[model samples]
Target: MSTQNVAERAVIREARPEDDAAIGELLVEAFITQYAKKLPEVVYTDERKRELRDVAARRKVATILVAEVDGEVVGTVALFPPGAPGSEAWLPNSADLRGLATAVRFHGTGLAKPLLDAAEDLARKWGVDAICLHVRKGAEGVGRLYMKRGFVREPVGDMDLPSVFLTAYVKPLK
Candidate 1:
């Protein structure tokens, strides 16, 4: 099916507690399994996998949004307002996004854009001036997707972590 067709059938909403496990599984599947070749093995450490699966902990500081297709969670993205625990935003008054994941089966189904759109909408609602995120440095396709969605590379916000180097992107809301 085409991206538009699948996207039309998808529902985007804030995740409920019941959806936590599925979101974790989806994250691992999309990040570690599906895009394995796009990142280094070191990036997929046991700690990182646990972090990906820790939906409840992450939810404490950010709003977790899920994309549902046929009543199943297929994608998720976390939006963190300024000063939230997970936000690595360097820009003042910016919201940060993390853990943007789409199930392997939904790849090329355009579910990502809706998920991102929802995050941006939420950020706007929170009165933030911009939304920012960091993508793994080597994930070219993911970076392209963000760029195509109007997120500009903000190299000054980039960071180097023990697991992977991150490249920053930001989308201005006003």
Candidate 2:
């Protein structure tokens, strides 16, 4: 991230099959860091790690996107198209955004915003009228980020995971 503007470190692009492993590693690392302070147990669990590792096998790479810096995969996000099988619960003409993870070292390097913009761009390309994503209740920073990006909280489901209450937000595409 040196010698160029902070945002120049990573170049966002469509992810390929070969990127699956790197993306999984990024997710595991980020998830572990996220839980290290409060939910340390999650950091030691292999079940979740294995599930993350199986992402490539279960998901279509074409539906994934990555951010690379000097040939290293540093961030990943998934944009599920409107009406996609697993995304049927979303409002009509609205796509879903999930699986957002970024390398720890790249924090504060402005890598995430571009990746998010890319995801929204993808949703708009699908001719969707809006895009939706979920954020855990306590993740105020994440919520603020979404709000800053025009997302408005619109609670949807009660299927929360243990202590983490999941809430949905939607941002209309114009």
Best-matching candidate per TM-score: 1
Which candidate comes out best when scored by lDDT?
Answer: 1
Worst 10 residues of 2 by lDDT: 35-44
Candidate 2, residue 150: the lDDT equals: 97
Global lDDT of model 2: 0.76
lDDT (Cα, 0-100) at 45 in candidate 1: 72
lDDT of each candidate versus the true structure: 0.87, 0.76
> Model 1 Cα displacement at 150 (Å)?
0.7
The residue-by-residue lDDT of candidate 1 on 123-159, one tens digit each, is 9999999998998877878889989989999899999
Q: Please give the RMSD of candidate 2 to the true structure.
A: 2.6
Clashing pairs in 2: none
